[model samples]
Target: MTGRSDNRPTIVITGASSGIGQATAEAFARLGARLVLAARGAEALEQVAAHCRTLGGDAIAVPTDVTDAQAVRRLADRALAFGRTIDVWVSNVGIGAVGRFQDTPIESHEQVIRANLIGHLNDAHAVMPVFLRQRFGTFINMISLGGFAATPFATSYSASKYGLRGFAEALRAEVADQPDIHVCDVYPAFIDTPGIRHGANYTGRKLSAPPPVYDARKVAAAIVDLARAPRDTTVVGSVAQFVRLGHFVAPGLSGRVMARFIRSSLDRAERVPISDGNLFAPPRDAGGIDGGLRSPKQRALVGLAAVAGLALAAVLLRSKPAYGRTGHAERGPALPPPTPRLEHSR
Candidate 1:
């Protein structure tokens, strides 16, 4: 922890062109951390780097597709070249596709798995050697609540996140004794970023959950906090925490409840063409290639929904602690047996 205060620690972040990644870059830059920002979009990466520079931190933009192992390796090389010691490497690249499992194309599933799961693996493989050599470094993987539970219409995404979560947990234990090296996983719920609207394709043309989403800035702050303290895992929002708790307390029940909600939402949602002759890209590219959940209205709605869900969860958990678990208490009333719920989409 005792590194140069003036120079700060150098950090490499993937998916740095926008959303949580961009916000994280800015946050670290504000703290004087030298940055090597990587993302697929060169133009957008440059913009983020410029903003980081304006914030009084040195940054180099490396256009990278995390799905490409070679490109990810180059990112690690660039970070090492920038600073002999890379203090942190954050894998934040991810994409999502939402639709009924049968309707969702195989290509969509493959792409998301590559971006969300294999991408993180590529990043870790690229940076682990550097951390091993230095005997000191941190790996931060941007995971999602979807990793913990499945949601309807997002089967591919849920699978990817779940895989990543398992990878992170196993890796943590594998390197537990290495005090000099740290691996942390962060789980955040719907974030108010253009990525939501642009990155995900809703089969029903609507979001399963209501709004009141978290701001990227909030997540960024938490990332910075993680950099300083290095916890094994952290949930970035109340909804995220609730989901985690739900998974632990009543695994099947949570999934079933979430499935019902998702089913209802999709049932009532409007279905529209997801493409305009563009097979690869999602509609509403409204936020540009790298932008996240672009619309202000959508952002507000998501945020409100997140807040409401958290509030309701809190009330339910507090008023009926037994609802999450199935057991007979000696003194209190016996709780009903928990039923499995449909997995939530992250």
Candidate 2:
């Protein structure tokens, strides 16, 4: 609204080429928000921007790699110049790698942390000044369930997500005096998105998201709602809510269950060559919203009751000790690793 010619809310969205970013851009476009879309790929970024324009939103594409603080500063500079003022900034870029701590390359770990954590920091660094100047803005952080609890194979990803949660909390406290400035964090469960296809995989398994996946547009709707009425935390999906509470009340058992599920899933999954995925580079072309997991009828599927039952079972048995006849600790019976029920993908 500041220095703007019209009343359309000006918005900046990063990671705008694919997945939730693209969906969110489309959602806001339909709402008539002026958009500045940024991603690593110029052509793909432009494609999303073009689509937004078709939806009746004013849009421009700015190709940017958020890991570089300077580039992010430039992005902010361009966005502010184009929109006259940034009404909302979505720090939605995230990357992940799936593997044990040692099996995954150090570079992959560093890159994930850089993009997921440090890149978010850069976005905040650039936008906070603009928000302060305007005295009104919303900064949205796209965190995940990993922020609430530890993810087994994805050590770096868990670290980055947790770091993002803490970062958002700190920002919220720092800006408490600013009555109109808002810092919001969104946590979504396993959604059908191309993000899984883009994750680095060192486990040598064909990755697939587990069943009961939600749609990417579900997250987009939540983001749109948050933009309209900013909140401290917005969680998407029933399972995400259960998992967040499960971890808060039963950290030990929750972590153990998650670790076992991932290990068993990987063990039973079909073998494939390890891949670095799109960690260091962007995909060849722009991708779509869905990741082939959700159908028209399947989008409503959510196993929240099943997840709660599992958590209850784990809590009830957490006190049991596994010991052999000699009083030494012993492993429990092997879990049936039939068709992976819980995968280590996005």
Candidate 3:
């Protein structure tokens, strides 16, 4: 355990007002972790902290803008003041912009990079010193499968994820000598979160993570698990593994497949106006952990099943032989008809 035996462990989570961060905070709270929640929405952050408290955690809300380095530093100071020490710092603030790269405004792209990549960097900068002083701490970076695969409409999101993945790797390498100071990355596939509703949707269509979307709690579980058993990387959903494998085996084909999938999903979705949600300001609503967009019963295995079905169909199509109008096999001899038999009445 990261916390002291006498008291609850201290955990600081950014983007705790809603979505995956809120879910993660709740998960840790169940384990009796003292939480310091940070987000732009002060009211929402406080609400989440209250919920955590209800879950048996001692929590304090610290409204902060992670893109501002000084603000993040102040956040760290606030957390230390609240818990007296920090055991884990979760850099979970991330946003997405979905549209054709050229069609999307350059400013929107820059904003994604700033919030998703630079904000995480700021979190590390502010907390690493504290970790060094204490000689033990864990920083969890919430990266998505996009970190490994190039997404078409979400160009900036892909860039930020890729950059964040690299950042975690480098940070882990730098802290390799410190056995207790850990840098961890969580890569989840499409998750059910308000992020779909809050993201900047320039695709001229409604934005939603394609199913089978995993629950935010699924990712949260992995984050909470890190406090006990810290691993360099943890992938939450099976789809993440599949995407990584596909990308590694056939980068060009995988990219094209992803592009086609995005295009189809967007084109089929209902239209929605463009908005830079929570990018320049606080979120309009205190959206809960689950986005209500995905079913809790959904599993990443559904995707695997679909792929397996398609592969079976392809194999069957390739192996089947052409038949004439008589419907006999073209590649082999026809079989003889079965003899008829009569049965006696009992």
TM-score of decoy 3: 0.85
Positional deviation of 287 in candidate 1, in angstroms? 3.9
**What does candidate 2's lDDT look like per residue over 195-248, in tens digits?**
888879999997776656887887887777667667788878767766776787
Instruction: List, residue by residue over 1-346, the lDDT tens digit for candidate 1.
Output: 1123544688899988777888888777765678999887777788889988887668999988888899899888888888767888889987888777888888878888998999999999999888889887889899987977876677888999999989988887887777768888888876766665555564747553444466677787767766666777777766776677668778889888988877777778787657312224323322322333436776556566567767767766775553221211111111112112101112
- Give candidate 2 misplaced runs (Cα > 4 Å): 1-5, 295-346
* Whole-model lDDT per candidate: 0.73, 0.81, 0.80
The numbered model that scores best in lDDT is 2
lDDT score for residue 304 of model 3: 68
- Lowest lDDT block of 10, candidate 2: 324-333
Q: How many clashes in candidate 1?
A: 31
- How far residue 19's Cα lies from its native spot in candidate 2, in Å, is 0.5
Q: Could you tell which candidate, 1 or 2, scores higher by lDDT?
A: 2
Please identify which of the two predictions, 2 or 3, would achieve the higher TM-score against the true structure.
Answer: 2
